[model samples]
Target: MRPLEVWLYGAGLVLSFVAIVSLTRSIVVTIAKRKIVEERKAVQQEVQKKNEELVKQSALVESEYFVEREAREKLGLGREGESVVLLSPSATEPGIAAPVPEAVQETKSNFRLWWELFF
Candidate 1:
């Protein structure tokens, strides 16, 4: 073959190699970018959920029922029409069935209650 033809073939081979390497690198970078975007979206969703939970807790803390319950339970104070009852430890003996406390009666959402009933 002529020297010019050999040099042209060599240059074509090198160009093809470079193109393949460039394409492979681009694919890897694109995949990594997509993964990063997905991770960021997941983290943002988690943060939004936490913010919603905080808002719910804030609302509950600000409610009158929560405040009154806390005051009555913690401070041993009651409203004018209410009377407080205290039971001694000995009154809750092994044979006697104790009354269920108010705190134990959790207020469940209707959805949760139905789910629990069905499931």
Candidate 2:
């Protein structure tokens, strides 16, 4: 073959190899970008689904019947025309205060009187 023809062929081969490498790199990058986009879309969908679920749960809790039931049970409240009877707990429970003896009251009064007299 002629020298110029050999050089021209070699140049064309080099150009083709460079083009293939560039195309391959571009293809890989494009595929990676597509995958990332798909993942982002999936994550967004999941978040939206969770948000919808939360909205539904909040709506259930905010319903009037749920509020009324909770109030009736927890606060001893009654709806209109509904009778509510409250029963007192037994004295043995922790919240009840024991009655003080009359003697103790008299002693305390005397002590207060003595303290005032001294001061």
Best-performing candidate as measured by lDDT:
1
- Best by the TM-score measure: 1
* TM-score of each model, in listed order: 0.64, 0.60
Per-residue CA lDDT of model 2 for 1-119, tens digit only, reads 99999999999999999999999999999999999999999999999999999999999999999999899889999989999986546546797776655854444687798999999
Candidate 1 TM-score, C-alpha based:
0.64
Task: State the C-alpha lDDT per candidate.
Answer: 0.93, 0.91
**Candidate 1 local lDDT, 1-119, one digit each (tens):** 99999999999999999999999999999999999999999999999999999999999999999999999988888999989987668676778776666866678899998999999
Clashing pairs in 2: none
Error of 1 at 46 (Å): 2.2
Clashing pairs in 1: none
